[model samples]
Target: MRHFIARGAGLLALVALAGTASAETVLGTPLAPPALNADVTGAVAKHFTDAGGLVFKDLKPSKARGGKGYCGKVATAADAPFVPFQVILEAGAAPSVLLLSDADGASPAISEENATLLLKNAGCLE
Candidate 1:
């Protein structure tokens, strides 16, 4: 019985390690989610006309394209609630702004039919 318990513990440890191994990073550093720095916020703001009022939070490196971009939640104003948003950047290509919606089908501009899939693709969802 002790042998079996030890084996189970080992298996659990391996599973935990595997989960951390697959996490995406912006600067090749594990356990550090990307920050919503000025460059990233600027890149996203350029796509909008009035982004001065926007506030970003919960930023993370995108898993797509081998962690080449960033994803997070943004609030249009201090009084507004935060919404999921993604900015996928590619070399020599304009950044892509993926629209997302909240659980109630509101926020992030509008309710997109593919919001869930987009969120998944952007790594906004687990």
Candidate 2:
């Protein structure tokens, strides 16, 4: 009985180690995700714009490409609740996406549908 128990414990340990072996991580390295939030997506666009010697502020939406949608600068309302926000939307078969860069100069926020608009109205998406 003791021999069997010992063997079982060893096998369990081996299995656990094998499971962990397949896991990998990168430390202190920046790898961009396929889809990002408002802040990250804006940063990515800025990266490309800066690389191309184009002013980020002057950037405009081209058109929807594939499953992606696009948005330009934001319009602020004085009597509103949310912040000024610039956003982009990408509509695909999966998730309808929205990206917001806060024009309020506070923080960038990401949301879907009206949530992004609400954040914009709240002045969080800068």
Candidate 3:
């Protein structure tokens, strides 16, 4: 009886851990701080190759369905119009960048599907 109870307790512990693990974000439980300058510049360069004069601003720690990372805005200049952006940086994983809007009603920098997913994960959408 004692041995059976011990085994049952072990099984219960394992089940509990599994449940919590499934709730954790696959992108990374607690994402790492992004190399703001380098990462943001690289994202801009990659996503908006022909664009220029863009600057990153209002960066702050953010936690969302996607994971924990940084959220901020990109603007053409200090006082220029801006668009929202979310960057998810994780060790050993490629960085994820979501350029939400063009700030001029233009199409997004990335594909529609990707933009939507990022927006949802970033809690911008329900």
Best by TM-score: 1
Q: Which residue window of length 10 is worst by lDDT in model 1?
A: 14-23
TM-scores of the candidates are 0.56, 0.18, 0.47
Candidate 3 lDDT by residue in tens digits, 64-126: 433435666666565767666666555675555555553222432335555555555555444
- The alpha-carbon RMSD values of the candidates against the true structure, listed in the order shown, are 16.5, 22.5, 17.4
The CA lDDT at 3 in model 2 is: 28
> Residue 67 lDDT in model 1?
60
Candidate 3 lDDT trough over 10 residues, lowest sum: 14-23
Give the alpha carbon lDDT tens digit for every residue of 1-126 in model 1: 222222221222211112111112222222242333555565545544456566666777766654656777666565677666666555685455554533233233333544555566557765
Q: Which residue pairs does candidate 3 place in steric collision?
A: none
Report the lDDT of model 2 for residue 83. 18
| Candidate 3 TM-score over all chains jointly | 0.47
